[model samples]
Target: MATDTDFIHRVGDLAPALRSGGQRLHRPLLLLWALAQAVNGKPRQQPWSAIRASVTPLLATYAAAPGDQAAVYPFWALRNSNLWEVEGSEELSLTSDGRRPTLSVLNERDPLAGLLAEDHDLLRREPSVAARTASSVLLRFFPDVMVDLARDLDLTTLLAGGIDGALRPRVGEPYANRTAIAAVYGGNGVGGITPLADGILSVYSDDKGPYDDRRVAGMDWIAYTGDGLAGDQKMSGGNRSMSTYRAEQRPLRYWHKPHGGVFTFETWVVIVQCRQRWGVGQNREPRREYVWILAPVPSPLRATWPEEVKEALAQDVADDLKVHDDLDVDLPPVALGDPQGAMTDMERYRKLSAAARRTAAGRTDRSKLTKVERYVRSTAARQAVILRSGGRCENPTCLGHPTELTDKGDPLLEVDHVHELSRGGGDTPESMIALCPNCHTLKTRGSGRQQLRQALLVRAKALHRSFAGSQGEDEKRREPTTGQPL
Candidate 1:
């Protein structure tokens, strides 16, 4: 039950108290951009990922205050106005104040937000109203940049009382081959990369092509090799397109040619991570290349993804946070210490562990492990341990949260098992402990694995006891004190 008039009223009154201090264009800019989307007949529900990549730069450009500008602030705050609607609010765990989702949660979870659907529809139908709302934003917040903004967004169409009817580019259905794909999508169709529809794509094949794309087993994402056959890969060209921070982000498309069949659109993707590592180029010379870690664009709400895929995606996302420790994320929960939730999560991991063992039953050795998404371990168990670790390495030798923290202001730690799960260890909190990536690798694959394991076993036992004692204290504090007023 929304109308263009209601939205116009709300839009005009956005953050009025804050506006009195200085003209802040963050929310107004978002509104204008959304209005433009409506004028062009785009979908009402815009993904946060898309909005981040699109509006963040604009916020940096237009905001009056240096410290208060961020796409996340406006995108999350606008819902209070009732003009904007978010698709994934319930799933958000929120902050300690029970206010907003954390930056990490907002970044990792692909929540959809934009103008209310009814308002979007009405705005699209009545261009004059849309134009009026936009004019008000210009007159109030960013009058100086109205002409520049108009040029950038091509707002002339809307201001002239018309819809541009801009069509979103799509990857349609399967193509006969790379050739067939290029014919329609307009790429060279020779290598892994295809430039089409304002996005970059990567193809995976067994053939010895220029790009040696590999989807490792038990992993949902692909380590997409950067373009160029020789030397270290640079952060230019198609490689830039895959990086979210480099001002080259675009919609990521996953095009697969399975069993050497016709090329098919797999799913839309967003880069979970990107890393440069030592490798051999196509010509077999020593080189390093950027590996763009691509995960499926998560659903706006609850994921309908395959179980294995979802599991691996969860692991990759955690890995992504670890790798980019300093990257800023918005707000959500690793802190409430919800024991019941942790218990349920741990039980789910137990099943995943057994399933993983069954899937790899016939594999001769670890080296021969098939490139199918099956893992004999649980990311949930790992995460539970990480939660228990409180962000610092659990090793007694390194017992404090690191100086460096993940964007969400949490410590980066890896869950390590005191006894190997593969060697018949239980999948419970006591069996696993969290450590920093350094200690984890040293314990699992280093020379003194036995010594580290023994030390971790002792430390983990003490850690759990401490956690239990702390929980009891917290409960006692929450309960009424003896002889207190009831």
Candidate 2:
């Protein structure tokens, strides 16, 4: 007849070994002990059947001998030393009287409950402890396994494949931001992690993947460490004064790329010369200092030949500069007052300026006709008359719309004479019609004026015929055509 105290200690010692083998007998024993204690005052036998049923399956396969099987009874007895009634037994189906004690309740009453509560509190506070512990154990024992996984995957190829998969199905889809992928992972910090320049880092969402190849360069580690100016005090007998001046001069050059993106092998050479400096004393003379060149290796993994590579690149730039200098020496300056040449250039510029003004004015002019008179001249007024006569353009084949023919909804129509204005054709509505930008360019091309005028006349005649035909079918007679008044 072993005492309950001795049995509890023995069962407690075996608990860890059994748990290591993945057996779960202790929880059910504890639950049964709690239930028995809850019904202590009432005349009721323990619910042995329910407790046995709950825990039997868990221990049955592991208990190989009859002696091992008998260990369950003492285990149940020791755990039930203290228990309390559960408020929600009906939902749990643990008791017919609608009351039962749970292991949670028994633990609260047990003398060692404070230690158990503290352990539970610690586990709750740091849930990641279990996962971190497991990972540490695995890594300590199995370094080779992790290396094999790394070898099986080519990270760059996998990332590119993911990007291609996302874009292939949505061909021709307009990207709102073309630089989004580059901005996220192209060697810049993402979260709180400082971006490392010698390694590759990437992120993969369910729908997209972005990555960057970071390379260590000389410029990344360089720093400016010297100061140029210092303050000094001078004493002459009892009189003292302070003066500030620069000393031990050295030219400083700070190198930076205009666009921060991946730099290739040939792109890292930058040359700078100090143009000007201030803060030197009045007596001290200013002079141009040394020219500086900065070059960085594009890849961290490769060794750099900094001196040789920088010299080669600088010589190439010097050669290009020499070629430009030689060309400037041979060109002659234009003589002043070359009226014939000046007039030719002015005429060319005037035509270009006129075209530019027409484009700027658009299709409409709503400026007070006063402003129109000031800026809109002979060719523009002629164009306006043509737009008003045709509504759009008389050319049936023309695609120009009334709204498309104006700047700010003011008409941009330009008139073309059926016969040249210089050759006796009057500037009247009948002789001119509207033309859009495309047609106007065609009419003004070399030797095409006569053909363009004929084309416009044909379109105008067709339009008139259509209008006349529609009017003839109506019951009321139409108004007569008003020819231009002299």
Best by TM-score: 1
**Mind giving the per-residue lDDT tens digits that candidate 2 earns over 407-476?**
2233344556555544444333334456666666666673776676677755544433343344212311
For the record, the alpha-carbon RMSD of candidate 2 to the native fold, in angstroms, is: 32.4
Model 1 per-residue lDDT tens digits across residues 1-486:
566545555664564334555545666788788888888878888888898887776776666534322776778777787778788688887889876777778878879998888888888888766776676566445545666776666688666632211211234468777777666545457766544421234443432245546664335566666766788777676665455321222234577765556667766555545555444465545465666656554421113344554454455555553332111111111242344444543343333333332343454343211232222123334444565565677887763444345433446665655776446443445556878777877887889888888878767756654554554244336433453211
lDDT of each: 0.56, 0.29
Candidate topping lDDT: 1
Task: For model 2, state the Cα shift of residue 250 in Å.
Answer: 61
List, in order, the clash count of every candidate structure.
8, 18
TM-score against native, each model: 0.33, 0.18
